[model samples]
Target: MNARTNIQFINNELGQPQFVVMPYTQYLELSKSKQIDTEAGVPSEVVNMVFDNNYSPAQAWRKYLNLSQVDVANRIGISKSAYSQYYKIQKLRKSMRIKIAEALQIKPELLDF
Candidate 1:
């Protein structure tokens, strides 16, 4: 049977696609691939921060990348004190977060507070 034949779809009242149901085996396969994609080149510290919540995402990523506060601040064109304050706040503005993410070589979404 074709792949589509093994899947089921649920529609909303307007007949719009709302949910998908696939075979358990197919779901497992897809999950494994996605896990691999997410883990590749991802530092353990970063993963721990994302999953464990013990450390701020920025702190975790900065440590994982072996960067100091001053280093990141300089890269993002901010002063060390300003960087320290922002990092301590753990609630960065979106634009500043994106710039910091770029400095750290990571996606901005990963820095979500």
Candidate 2:
């Protein structure tokens, strides 16, 4: 492969490169050739759902996926009311978080916020 000459590296506060900038045409080519992990990010709709509606991460994801609480509870093998309590609780257990992620088919890290 030829070395990239048009790419630009952007640094963060510590001066370590935090982003990569390239021509849109080059980006289109690279994206077609590579298998990007789409799961590594969340949609702006989810963020809006949280800030605009006061929804928890789980709640936001649930609404984003158009799933009802009963559906999530059924997926996780818990009662509907039990799942409802999760949103009311301040913090969730790691196991519960994992279970919720599995039910939503999303990475647990997405719910970390």
Candidate 3:
């Protein structure tokens, strides 16, 4: 299906493009497609756990994926202790955050505070 996207670009004072405005339906369609591309075959229970509000984004995804801190640490080339500290600080360098999100098969923004 060819979906029609009605979009408008909002420019900054300097005339550079700064924002995009689209209909809610279009936004949902785009989000669904992106999620499908990234999350194919991931269990819905895992997705729900990741989206649960009680846990920090990292903790939720990590637990849902049944990954130990050491596992993520190894993937991101950091120490297990350092990875544990990420939850305490609730902050990660943008690049590291993106790496974690990639490891979890979700968008980076989902892990952002």
Among the numbered candidates, top lDDT falls to: 2
Candidate 2 C-alpha lDDT tens digits along 20-49? 898989877866777545578776798898
- Full-model lDDT, candidate 2: 0.85
Clash totals for all models, in order?
0, 0, 0
| Lowest lDDT 10-residue stretch of candidate 3 | 35-44
Q: Which sections of candidate 2 miss by over 4 Å?
A: 1-9, 13-17, 20-36, 88-90
Estimated TM-score for each candidate: 0.57, 0.72, 0.50
Highest TM-score against the true fold, candidate: 2
| Candidate 3 lDDT, 1-113, residue by residue in tens | 97766888899999999877988787678777774343434444555655565565677778877888888888877888877777533556788789888776677776765
Q: Rate the local accuracy (lDDT) of all candidates.
A: 0.78, 0.85, 0.71
Better of 1 and 3 by TM-score: 1
After superposing candidate 1 on the true structure, give the runs of residues whose Cα lies further than 4 Å from its correct spot. 1-44, 50-53
